[model samples]
Target: MRAFLLLLFVFLTLGAAPARAQQPTPTRVIEALYDQLSAYQLRRYQPDSGYQLLTLPSTFSGPELAALRLRERQLVRVDLVYSAYRFDPKFSQRQLNIDRLRNLDERLPGLLMDPSITWNLIEQTGCTTPDECQQYFHGFVLYIEKRYTKADTKAEIGRLTARLNATEKKIERIRAVRKSPGKPLACGYPHVEDKLRKLTKRIKKAYDCTQKDRRPRTVTFQAEVSRQGKVLNVRLPAVDSAGAAAPPCPEELTGAIAEGLAFTDGFLLGKQRLPFTVTGRLSLPLRPQQGFKVTGYYLADSLMRKYRVKLLRDGCQARQLRPGDATEEDPIPNPDPNVVTRVLERHPDWQKQTVVADVTGSMYPYTADLLIWLQLAAAGPEKTFVFFNDGDDLPDKQKRLGQTGGLYDARTNDYGRIRQRVIEAMGAGGGGDAPENDCEALLRAHQLAPEAQDIILVADNHTFPRDTKLLEGTRLPVKIILCGVTDHINPKYLALARRYGYSLHTLDTDLTNLSELPDNQITIIEGVRYQTTPGGFRRVSGRAE
Candidate 1:
């Protein structure tokens, strides 16, 4: 009686089944060779010759696996099977798949590195893992693609080299621009400096006797003034030196000081129309006889000046501020609440996850949100992140779908390093076009962390993926966390989700059934009507309320 036949290694050893004529001994070389073969299969392709598959009898082992070398051909898939007569007979499909996956995983690295191969072995089916995939009786399959000619390959390498060089130069240029401290604004008018001094004096007087605590207190305010001398915006620091929230000043005092600063004239300026910011810190007196002390720095024409305060018995007086060493002009903005944290918190199962985030200019808030999550979350070695900034400032015309290469990777528990990576990617490039190389970034991220079970993609809902066509090549389950979405979901994301069966996570809800929705079926999300299509979802009405 013949037993059930399954692919690769199996436990099906029941009654008698015809075994292959010869049984070969298993060796580590064969395992390593299989690993190498799998490595080839995981590579990205440029539409070369297609992949091929080969199956061998479980009994047909030994050096045969290691001896495989096609002259110009690539081995994309390889399977090892167990002879039915020798192994245990009653093996379920689940166990069989699990065994096969284990075998494949045992040799994953060789497959990931080999450029000659091209097929995502782990994601060969709709399911990414063996546990979730349905197993069927099938022979081994190898997929391959033809490579470029010798001359073409050389030329392609040269082109890529030049592109890489150009991208590096672009990044350097961005760094230089950000690091430059411009020439100081030449404010020739002496009276303008006098007005700034008097303004601080009035601010100190307003804050006098305001605090309930008798001890010394420091009140700080940052204000931006246009070149024309008009006070633009005034804000108190959210937090002080000790990490405590800055105590709020009386509204009346704040209003009075703002008005006083606005009325002061003679803000001399240059040809460039940039705002000069003032950061003032007023230290209240420690003793009854002592006066309030006010000292701070202001940037005028890219030059920094430190105001000197002299304490008097009655009240401190302000005088000319000496020119101080230049520093970054603007204070860092406070981090705004974002949806990335909210979405991730709701899904606690996203463990050992690889995060791929867009670090473009508009997505800075979301990027900060990710950092906040990392800082506050439990510490561990499991977190891995990839930050991509749409090609390192590459010009729109020069960027290709899969090659738009501004991707930075970090795998560590240190939140600071992850933050630095985000800043480097952001400073290098902040996407030129409205559409970003989202799929390209994701694919690279997958390569960076193939073993990661959950891939969390933090994307911009407003920007569609420039490389949406490449989505099919990725072999992981991607949970897209969309930021900056307002009334309606971007139809492009919906389309990708629909075709690929991805779940879309927004600030409030998750659309997991997009892929399973029947064609032309209507559904409502957040008061928005959408109809499912074969390709993706289409909005049937206007923006959602």
Candidate 2:
């Protein structure tokens, strides 16, 4: 009887061993855990940000783990174990609740040391289906080293303060120029046709493009005018190789013309005689159109509609002129220039830039300016352009901070291809919200142009960037050319510049640094008062002290 009982016990124990063998081994379960964690990391990781991943062995001491956690930025960790739970109709939350509690522990079990060990107790699932479904527990240990440390951000703050001091000095120089008086010149005031004729004769010798193409074409030129009515600088559009194929006019001509040109009065915006840029044209084959026609090139058409502009007197009059004498182009017609134009005009030294623009509908005005600037500037392979819509028609809920993407970049200086990329990004998505994925676009721009000298971010003033957290991962010097700023600047941008050492630029003001100011110190910029605080900064209320 004893021999028969022993045989039955052995047979029953063998049957249970086969059932346990069907479950996944600890190694397979840990592998599955890493797969899930990797998906989460993929969403936020920036290229070249320097992150380390580690899968600690189960035998790792608790003290060692604590030391690692102290030295590195503990991005995230997952602690779980893999085991099958019995199918249950009523207790579906049972297995999930237990697994979560286990993950919350400071130290996870060393599953690698005992691959064959089991919890022994089976938990019930919350499954409600008529058919049976299998359920299992998951376990893993994932550590992601963070990129930015507290010390890194602190050092950037110091740099920002230094930059701000330098900017203040630059403002002083600008103010001195603005205070000067408009000089008297031989040119008559507002005699548009007569003055144009005289001016054209002065520049006829320097208008070299006409020598190459006898075709009647209007080449437009833009000049900056100080509030004191002094002509500060001049720029002519790059030769249209696709069209007239003329070479750029001589630099000597631009310098000579700038030296001679002066307005009777500085351009006025409201009560202030602010600096402005004016556009005029040098038409080839010096002859007036047979019918009445506009004198200035169509370059400033958008600028005219957006700002108050006066034509030097519309409608061209017929006049015969000699080859050595071109018609005097109408005197400068001031247009309130946008940010893109201002940055390109003021910073001629900013070359080989990777220009990243937000291409939502709100940015159309600046987008037009960007296209215009690109058309006028000399083309080079080093200049890269990137345009982004918030997401490629992505639904709002699915948009994650650093991952939301509707970004396209063109490395070549080909205007046609650049324009196509702009169209492609815009077509993919209409910027969904007022807050944009600006930092995300910037990060992608850096990835595309890793060796670029600097990043020129053309941004909107009203909206704040959505992924500012990722700014810490950026490597290049960011020059933010902000648009739509009128009465007040956005404080979020101020904080960004302060924390990351980015320079903030508008039409007239450049905030290179926002650190070292005493708390509650008020600084006026471009007529707007801003108060600095430990938290960041804000547009001051009421009048300045």
Candidate 3:
């Protein structure tokens, strides 16, 4: 009795044990597949409903079963967990694995019969583990090796020859299209009715040429047609023969073709027709070497020159010129003696405007002139001056205003303490090779004066990644004036200006002497002239209009 009870207790304990601890229900494989499918859907034009996931055991097709087996090998842990729990509560873990393995073995042979479906199955399932994937990969390698060996037999020889013949036929078709004379005939056939007729005729000619054994020849011709629709001159420039066996066509053939085209009213009666040229080519498969060419001519016709122009009377009415016209004067009125005097006489509210200076590299001379003009204007504490730089390093030590030198001498100096302060604010500490993060600099500037309106960036428009980031993030209305930069302004800067509703000024030529630029709205000022030689400075005098 005691032995019987012990044996029964042992059997019950074995049956009640949990199914291999459930293995954390590995969901990573399914999640990864879902993510990949989502990414593919982003680029797909068709609806997602077209794709369907195949279930295992009964519903899976031969190719799908083979692919699953291959995936199972590569994604070993994930596949094992999936196989163990695919049917869940209906079947035990051991039963599920056995059923999947049996079904996979049975379906693989049928899957191998169709290579395209096999390829599709393998491609769709991006197996995560290596061992499981290598099983299917090894099978593919063996199959390919066998296929190549079979193809080498005498019976398969004709199949390979047939493929080559098909390829040759395709090449012949392409050559026919390339050498066709339709392109020349279709040129400038603007009217719908005329275009359709020309296109139809060209297609018929191309078909006829392809049917003949003689290869097509190509000829280029330049000609001039008079207003009365007569050929004035026609000459051949180049001739490409259809084939080596074919003789070159005479140049007279091209001339004849051009004469025919000229009388067809294709030439526009321009004041003088720019030397227009066309190529005439005969498309043939056998005689590709035969072709002709033609060259230049003049057209005599009633030519009408098309010119567009517009005139604006006032600066406010100027349609073409914007706020940042480079040739025009500064948009903000300069605080120079002459400009301030005119402003006082006209509106008497001349003192409210503010002045900002970009004391960056190569801008010292302009900044000095600006300061001098501001002093001359004398706005009696109403005028404000702001300074900034491309760099963002703080100064080592702050200098006393008058301790270093007299205020007059210090103020007159171009690149002195004031310039140093601007450089310090730019955070110029990471050596000379440090990248200038313009986005950070712009953000810092805004933080300093958030209330300021109409910020002007007076620097060369040499942009970087930081500039793009700044433009994308900020909504500030900032206009850019390219001072000394002549070429290669970064496109990102232009895009940023457009996005932020700002204007761009490209200043390459001289701006100090012009009284009035083509743009009437902007105000121009005469700054100091720049020279390469040492101690070479000249003053330019010009009145603003």
TM-score of each: 0.39, 0.40, 0.23
lDDT of 1 by residue, 1-545 (tens): 01112212232231122211123313333333233221111111222222233443222233543444332343432332211121233644334433454444343323322322322222122234444322422323443322223344344334433543454465445446434344433342212333545665665556554556455566677767776666777777667676756654446545645665652343333433335665555555322233322243244533323322223344323233335422233322213436888888788787646889987765755776777667556576757788887788787568776898989988888866776787677667756655678788778777877777778899876556757668765556888998877765766678788787778999998988887788768788877666665445555532101
User: Candidate 3 on 1-545: residue-level lDDT in tens?
Assistant: 34334433432443333312222212332222222110110111111121122234334567755664442221101111121112234545333333433444344422211111211111213334555534332111111101112223222334323433454465445445433212121112111222433533433343343343344444344555544445567555543343343224434344444434544443332222233233334333323233221222222222111111111222111112223332211123333323222323343432223334444432433443443333333334332334543232322122121121101111222323433343343222211111123344444445555665644444433222223334565686454554433322333343344445555545432222221222112232232221111111111121111
lDDT of 2 by residue, 290-359 (tens): 2112233221345333332334454212222223331122211113356888877888777646989987
Clashing pairs in 2: 58-110, 80-139, 81-139, 92-125, 92-126, 196-328, 197-328, 200-328
Q: What does candidate 3 score on TM?
A: 0.23
- Please name the candidate that would achieve the greatest TM-score relative to the true structure: 2
lDDT, ranked from best to worst? 1, 2, 3
Q: What's model 3's lDDT at 79?
A: 18
Total clashing residue pairs per candidate? 30, 8, 37
- Supply candidate 2's per-residue lDDT for 123: 20
Alpha-carbon local distance difference test for all models: 0.54, 0.54, 0.32
Is 2 or 3 the stronger prediction by lDDT? Answer: 2
User: Residue 283 CA error for candidate 2 (Å)?
Assistant: 48
Q: Can you tell me which runs of candidate 2 are displaced by over 4 Å?
A: 1-336, 473-475, 516-518, 542-545
TM-score head-to-head 1 vs 2, winner: 2
Evaluate residue 418 in candidate 2 and report its C-alpha lDDT on the 0 to 100 scale.
Answer: 72
